[model samples]
Target: MHEFSIAQALVEQIEAAATKEHAKRVVRVVITVGALSGVDPEALRSLFPLVAEDTVTADAELVVEPVSARVRCRACGREEAAETSFLRCSVCGSRDVELIAGRELHIKTVELEIDER
Candidate 1:
């Protein structure tokens, strides 16, 4: 599954950030995943723990926030939830709609612990 690759990337990012901030360990990683992002949340979570082995993020909790699919109709100026493939506006039933959200996959925040000397 591609979740392995995504998990690897997440670990790399977390390691870099933790090193830059001089963190002793990572506590949590908050990520935002859109409904249309095509990522399997269960699979992603399963891969994260494995990929984070022995890293600063090994003990970190992965928090995944799901974003809803939104679209705006060009003709009716209406905005509503959208389907994955069609992305049609529900209010106006128009196909000439622009996607407003639900296509994102990014790490929002990384909570880390600092060594207390």
Candidate 2:
């Protein structure tokens, strides 16, 4: 599945960062996933350990934060949560609405473990 590939890429990036920072291990990875990003968070989380095994993020915890879609109506100057299937302006009932949020997948923070010894 695409989740496996995504996990592979995440592990690679985490590993590279850990190496660069001279971290003994990665403690946690905080990621923000938008609802419109078309990513299955559960599937991605399941694939993480498999891909991260033997890597710098092997034991790292993966924290996924879900983001909801927000739409802004130009006709009524109103903003509200948009339905996943149909995004229409709640106030004006217009289908022409600008997506304000959702459709993003990014790593927000990385916690690392460093060894002084």
Candidate 3:
């Protein structure tokens, strides 16, 4: 699955960040997974460890925070939850809409531990 590649990339990114911060160990990596990001959270979670072997992120806790789909209607100026692949205003039934959320995959936080060595 492509989740392995994604996980590998994620671990590499975490390692880079941890190294830049001079961290002794990476304790946690919190990520926000959007509904429309097309990345399966469960698959990513299962594949993370495989790609993290021998890395600073090997034992880091991977916390996935899901973001629900949402859109902003241009006609009605209303923001509401939406289904994936459907961008319509529930109130005004307008096809003209702007995506406000649910299409992003962002690393929210990285919890690191520094050892006084």
Candidate 4:
């Protein structure tokens, strides 16, 4: 599954960050998952631990924040949350709209442990 690849990539990134920061251990990783990003959160979560094995983030907790799709209507200048893939302006019933959010897959935060010495 693609989620395995995504998890693998995530572990790679985490390992890089941990090494850069001279982290003794990784604690947690917080990421944002957009509704339109096409990555399933549950699947990603399931694969993360397996991919993280033997890595710096093997014991890290994964936190996923889900974001809803939002669109701005071009015809009526209306902005609203979208519930489906077919985007339409709720106020003006116009199909011409621009996606404002909910298309991002990004890491928000990483918690790490460092040796006091």
Counted clashes in each candidate structure? 0, 0, 0, 0
Root-mean-square deviation per candidate: 1.3, 1.3, 1.3, 1.0
Give lDDT: candidate 2, residue 84.
76
Score residue 99 of candidate 3 by CA lDDT: 88
Question: Against the true structure, candidate 3 has what lDDT?
Answer: 0.90
Q: State TM-scores per candidate.
A: 0.93, 0.93, 0.92, 0.94
Model 2 / residue 29 / CA error / Å: 0.5
User: Cα lDDT of all candidates, in order?
Assistant: 0.91, 0.91, 0.90, 0.91
Q: In model 3, state the lDDT of residue 9.
A: 81
- Report the C-alpha lDDT of model 1 over 1-117, residue by residue, as the tens digit: 888888999899999999999999999999999998889988999989999998889889999999889998999999888777778877768899989999889999999998876
Candidate 2: count of backbone clashes, pairs at least 3 residues apart or interchain? 0
Per-residue error for 68 in candidate 1, Å, reads 1.3
TM-score of candidate 2 against the unseen true structure? 0.93
Worst 10 residues of 3 by lDDT: 1-10
**Any runs in candidate 2 off by more than 4 Å, and if so which?**
none
Q: Which residue pairs clash in candidate 2?
A: none
Question: Per-residue lDDT of 13-77 in model 2, one digit per residue for the tens?
Answer: 88888998899999999999999988999999999999899887989999999999999998888
